[model samples]
Target: MDLKLSERYEDYREAVRVFLEEHRSVWRQPMADSDGRPSAAGRSWQALLIEHGYTCRTIPKQYGGHGGKADILESFIAAEEFHRVGAPTGLANQGISMFVPTLLECGTPEQKERWIRPTISGEIVWCQGYSEPGAGSDLANLQTRAVEDGEDFVVNGQKIWTSSAHFSDMMFVLVRTEPEAPKHHGISYLILSMDTPGIEVRPLKTMTGRAEFNEVFFTDVRLPKTQIVGERGAGWQVANTTLKHERGMLGDPGQANAMLGRVVAIMEEETLDGVRLIEHSGLQDRLLRLQARAQAMKLHGLRLLTHGLKGEDAGVARLIVKLNGTILNHEIAAFAIDVLGELGALYEDSPHLKDRGFWQTTHMFSLGLIIGGGTSQIQKNIISERGLGMPREPKPASKGA
Candidate 1:
């Protein structure tokens, strides 16, 4: 685990910094959809990232990517650079973050050829069809079914909390293909096009006044046999690969650090008791703690990346980092709101505001971090069982049993 970047990597870092600086003004606009939906500007930004070899940094050069080592340190640097200049990281969602990695690991060469390049190029957007009304954290109980029909599978059922489904062109779905087998063993993963006739996307509005998530209905939506990623009935295993990717995306410490920097800047611009808000000891103490946590999380991320590069299991560590990261984000958001006092209530673009009303929006958006990816409770269960080696929780008894 060398922390030292090679001369080449240092050069790469400097190049990325210069690109971001040149585009800083373009990236400064706040994304339109605060519910984590990608905006038109977001899509354009993603294309710029791909052209500059930032998106899919980990994909091999042979596969139409930059062929970097999938290094977490590099990801950290990239995230920090983007956040420092108020730029959104291209395609920071379950699709690019989770599904792309799964496809690379288990997909056929044809599938990769069909999907990966387009995804990286921002020509196609993707969503996850994992959670159903009944299945969320108990994802093994997912009811979306994909019945085999000749050279294609006919999918029917519904997916809930599908972020970006409305704007996405494709979705990576987990479907129940073998009803008679046990819950976890009877599933399969499929890639389905959103334009398929039977697919319906209805946006779900949240407290943030944004339609960021959607309820996706599949009524006989059909996918070609070639769309299946891994073997049928091995969806649970395939999902593990996706979750590992999710953990990495969610636990990214660079995002927290970026938010911390924004808070510091806001505090400097603000005043209280005839002095700057940043000079307040209470606020300073809290910011210091957040900075320390961000550093620790970064180091932990490095360890996970080193192990992952060596093909080692990092599931437990991923969960631990995600659990800690979300909590830290919530705390930082809370402090920002408190420090802003009455001014925190102002929305973006409001009259006579500080930092263009970003603090208020950030405070509102922070809660989603805890709930999305996987809930805090779900992360705790993983940590308890895998990290502590605790006994599995007892399953509820069936009515007939």
Candidate 2:
């Protein structure tokens, strides 16, 4: 594939750089909340990004986006420029990153008009309600029920590992709408307000000292039947769309490369026993291996984009991104901690902690991502059956059989 950019793209890159420089101070300010919700200033910055065509560039202006024509190269250039300067590309949340794309693909025109604007603009926050006590990896086994009651579906059951559910305004959920149908066939996708009666959110605290994940319980929650995204019993397909976007969002190349840059910076600047870590032959080999892997992932991302533009199937290349990207990010953060040596043990709030304990935080959070969107084992199964033309994994026999 050609790596060289045309003159127009070159100008686009320069414009992105100038935009970042002009708004660097404003973007640099910390958000009031750290658990993925954007603050007022952060939302303003996101709006600025939309206005300047730096983010949501392909989504239509009617939905509060840039409404530009599809240009993967330009999008990539903007991302590169933002990461190059350590500026946030835009506000990425469950609402903007995952749900908006799904809604654009499967939602009715009225649904888009009602939700997309506030969702992308950070005026509305959304949480996913897919995983449950029994349905995490084997999501078809979900037992959450939403029975029809006149114009509404009375929902009851629970969803665990729901990130930001406690603070979200809405949810895109899956439920067993047709109990007599086959497991996958019985599911339906529905959207509902989080503030509805009979809904409860209990936050789950992680080892990182954050209560971002939650267990959400719905007790006879009434949602209008009109809130269903696709036809009843077609949620599995619609959810696949959301899952694809979720994986892409979780396995962000820009964030991975940025974290690698931070690791490299730490290695060059920090000394171990009076010798720089980068100068050590053993450490140099490790860093080189990581840099090589990072470059490969970047090239793979470009190849995926190329396939997308050409209307070609990406095969396993697309499926491998989330698994490999998450592992690579975790390994890179682990390498930074190793480089930090004793200082790595120090958590945030310590005056002597390096990079304000950012690497340590990443190390923990990255591990959760490996399990969040889908586990590494689950991803391998998908690559094998879906990408490699292999036979599907055999299901376990029944108890009496």
lDDT of each: 0.78, 0.85
**Candidate 1 on 59-169: residue-level lDDT in tens?**
765556667656655665676666666566776666677877898899888887777876765567788888999998788999989888999899999999998898788
Tens digit of lDDT per residue, candidate 2, span 24-94?
88898864366557788888898998998877877899888899876666777777777777787777677
Instruction: Say which candidate scores most in TM-score.
Output: 2
Off by over 4 Å in 2: 31-36, 243-257, 399-401
TM-score of 1: 0.82
Work out how many backbone clashes candidate 2 has: 0
